[model samples]
Target: MAKTQKGDKALHSLFAGATAGAIEAFITYPTEFVKTRSQFGGKKEGPIAIIRETVKTKGFGGLYSGCTALVVGNSVKAGVRFLTYDYFKRKLSDSEGKLSAPRSLLAGLGAGMTEAVIAVTPSETIKTKLIDDAKRPNPQYRGLIHGTVQIVKQEGIAGIYRGLFPVMMRQGANSAVRFTTYATLKQVVQGTARPGQPLPSAITFGIGGIAGLVTVYTTMPLDVVKTRMQSLSARAQYRNSFHCAYRIFTEEGLLKFWAGTTPRLTRLVLSGGIVFTVYENIMKVIGNSGEETS
Candidate 1:
């Protein structure tokens, strides 16, 4: 049901997606750090409390410890996501210019799983370590390059993907929720708008933010497990994603699994808002340019 999407159109989607992801990561890095640490669940501090402590102990820079990795990883992750999602969605769509929820869900799942296998794991692993290790007075890894290189050297490339399955689970579910919710929200909003007129940017962003919050609430347990698996700590004792999940569920109960819900929600809500908004705007520009050229 989707329109013809190839050549410049697909490229536009990928570029827009990359731009969106980079912007989202940049805007949310600090909160992301807090979210990562919060997932550890050993600390009694809440989000704000943790932020205050980090600033006091490590300065504002502490909040942005994983920024480089966030930006790079998210750029690749989001770009790949939109690119793949659009392709798969077009492939799976019906002839009536409509997409069923299940198909959309599948498209999202495909997008997430693909990104997890490629970009998300390694980048997020580095980001997690940077945030989790920032508290050390003499942190072993210094910055993004040094940290990444060291992780690879010390633990091999496998270390960078330490929490691959959990990451996949979280991201795959996240994409599924995100695309479906955003698509649904967009359709709902457009239904109210004047025919042939676009939805307002504010409305679009609001939809994205709400969709992000939904995804966060739904996938937070996997996110917590992912963070724990990535972080270099003794407390994170587990053999695999299932093992980690079982441990958290059995030992910490269900509530503990959603430990970093607050910061994660905040980051993702804003990230989603920014990602969709920016992507749409960029696509608009690209489309206009392509038409004029044609």
Candidate 2:
């Protein structure tokens, strides 16, 4: 019975992560479009203006330009993140005989670090092309597949991983901070509630939102550089991740490094909140059912 319950929990966590990633993709697609456009650093249009222009010129479908990649990449990323997190949590809990906040933080860090290698590079490559195209002249890559093929052909498999190091850095740190903060916040919020009672959905969601905001903002500079490097062609300047970061910092001021942060942060908070909330609820349901079966 305990084994069955554990299996169920694992399955539920996977489902929750996948579902959350998919749903968040749709919910935050437009903001992503806006953020991408802003990253190019051309015309300083407000969020509303950028969104309006994108819709008017590109159509509503344009807002979801890189959504396919986002869905696929994020689904895998989230699946790994949650599964590994759960795995770590369960392992730690079993050893310690309790689920501790520090354990959850460690689990999230490990899961996040793992996902950085698995998902960030390819996803950033595709997304950066889509976003960068909005501002620059046509660089020849049509869409996700074309861009991927072009990179592979031109630079070989290594091309696809142009900004991999920074991506790993950004995503790894983001995940660790996000999950750790979320666990800490959830515990803090839950503790405020009456004894034997769970935290309210609002509190949980709020904490998740805050966590996402912190993570995104903290890592926005790395994200900006990652996008720029990935968007470049094989022949383009900025040879590698370090060179890309150096060039961006040298050419553009420090503030420029954080361009498009507003929309990105906004998207992160809202999407992160909703996704985490939904994920937690789904996990709860699965956990409860497992408890029942046991």
Candidate 3:
């Protein structure tokens, strides 16, 4: 019974994360498109300017240039994130016979790092290409499939993994901060609740949202470098994360590295809050069933 209940919780968590990711992708994809374009030095335009230019140049569908990759990437990313984190939480808690904050942190970090390897590389590759192709005279990829296949053929298996190191760094850091902070904050918020009362979804969502904002802002610089590195042509000059970061910093200045952060952070807040709230609620519903069955 206990094992069955655990399996149900895991399945529910995956479903919730995937649903939230899909919804958030549609809601915030334009911001993401703008952020990617700006990050790659395609346009220095603000979000509004970028949106206007994209529509003017590519039509209304322009804003969703990378929607396919975003959906697949985010779904896998969130699914792995929640599933692995939950797995770690259960294992760590059972091993110790208690849930510790550090255990949660480790779980989140491990989950993020793992997903970074499995999902982030190919996803970002497609996304970057789509965003960059938007301004090209003759676009290479008509969609995600074309783009991915082109990369595989032209650059080989290793090509799809471009900017992976920086991705791992950014995502690992982002998840480490996001999950650890969320775990700590959730406990703090729940501590003030009345005896036997559960923490509100709003509280959990709010805490997660704030953590997302902090993590994105803190890691924006690395994200910028990663985007640039990934957008480079297969024959382009730069080699490796260190070289890319150094060149961008030396040539672009410090503030340039943080370009598009405004839109990125805004998207994080709106999307993160909604996704986390929905995810927690879904988890709650599933958890209730598990409790009843137990």
Candidate achieving the largest TM-score: 1
Best-to-worst order by lDDT is: 1, 3, 2
Whole-model Cα lDDT per candidate? 0.83, 0.73, 0.76
Q: Which portions of model 3 show Cα errors greater than 4 Å? A: 94-101, 193-195, 287-294
Q: Tens digit of lDDT per residue, candidate 2, span 74-163?
A: 887887788777787667775535566666667767887788778767776777766666445454667788767776897797776677
TM-score of each: 0.93, 0.87, 0.90
Where model 1 places Cα greater than 4 Å from the true spot, the runs are: 1-5, 234-236, 288-294
Per-residue lDDT tens digits for candidate 1, residues 16-97, read 8898899899888888888887787464668888889999998888899989998999999989998899878878889965
Better of 1 and 3 by TM-score: 1
Candidate 2 whole-model C-alpha lDDT, 0 to 1: 0.73
1 or 2, which is superior by TM-score? 1
**lDDT per residue as tens, model 3, 193-238:** 6334565667656876887788887889888878887884523847
Descending-TM-score candidate ranking: 1, 3, 2
Least accurate 10 contiguous residues by lDDT in model 1: 285-294
